[model samples]
Target: MHATQTPRQDDPLDVETFARPEQQRRFVAAMHRIAAERAPGSSVRIYVSIAPGDANCERWLECITDDLPDGVELLHYRTAFEGAAYDWDALASRLDGLVVIGRPKRLGSRVHVLGPVARLELRSLVATKPVLLFTHNHGLVPVVDCLSQVMPPEEAPRLKLIAPKRWNRESITIRAALDALRPTGVSNAGLESFRAVQAHLLTPFSAASR
Candidate 1:
């Protein structure tokens, strides 16, 4: 399969504009940390999970691709289980980790329904490897609640939840998930860097805006 190209730095969805300078630095640093831990000359492969008809899919792809470091590659997988069940096992074998852009439909207060296609990809990825879920419509808690109903209790820990609105509170969680993406003998400096700036990483971007 062909690799997804790095987004242009001048793109409208640039992470620099999506997030503040310091926040973008921290996020980029975190990405670089992941890239650094990879085996020498090897690239870190992360599967980006999104629905086929999602209007914001391109935005999401561009923003994420812009922030990633040189040694990290994103494999964009548009979930369209139209004809038959997808071969998730085969896909999982090729990915190091998953980044799911969840745009679940809000059903009621504190309730949301993760689309069938996204749910299937999450369930499959979480079972096979680590997954960092970015909830767009609602915050992480409700989306995690939805997943808990469908995902077995044992498989739940493999998933890390994040919401743009709650980035400050969840920055540490995001850092930890990135660390877990590819474990190595690297120091905890990256994690500490996130802690130092977690409070200032305010201003949620439009990607997670309702």
Candidate 2:
């Protein structure tokens, strides 16, 4: 099935809880850097997936599309309802990378799982490419647990973990989590591309702060 770009749905009661200004800045900066690195005349195609019924979904969509960089296109997809099977592979084939926004819930002492639809999308998306998961209000451990559920047993443990020094307050922590997936060998090209984006996101901000 073809991936349809979901229209932005506005909910009056929905509050801006996840997509913070700083995080949005970092995300957009990273996308711009990714776009710049593309071969001349080529565009970067990024598939952004969000769970169905997430109040913050439209917020993220707007943050990504607003003033988006040239040569970078975002294809937005809201995961299908529970028990619905959409052809994720066909969609993944046309994308350069994947970004999944999830709200992880703690199930146990150290276990976490994304919502049903988000978890399903995460499982499908990660099978072909490394996924950058943007999570809210959760730490690295919960995020790692979410990834482990979708990754192979051997590869899951091999995955690395990187966190900014002040992970609790920095948006770079999300980027660091994505970087940690390098050892799993999801997609070398995708990872390398993101490495450049990560550098671009961090270096300039670090320099300016100094």
Give residue 129's lDDT in candidate 2 (0 to 100). 42
- RMSD in angstroms between candidate 1 and the native structure over all alpha carbons: 16.2
Q: lDDT of all predictions, in order shown?
A: 0.46, 0.42
Q: Model 1, 35: alpha-carbon shift in Å?
A: 8.9
- Considering every candidate listed, which one attains the maximal TM-score? 1
- Model 1 lDDT tens row, 36-90: 6667434456777776556776666656544433334456543323455677767
TM-score of each: 0.47, 0.40
Candidate 2 local lDDT, 108-191, one digit each (tens): 122234445545555565534435544333332212223143423442322221211123423343444333222332355765
Identify the candidate with maximal lDDT: 1
| Model 2 CA deviation exceeding 4 Å by range | 1-38, 64-71, 78-85, 106-112, 124-130, 137-147, 150-210
Error of 1 at 104 (Å): 4.0
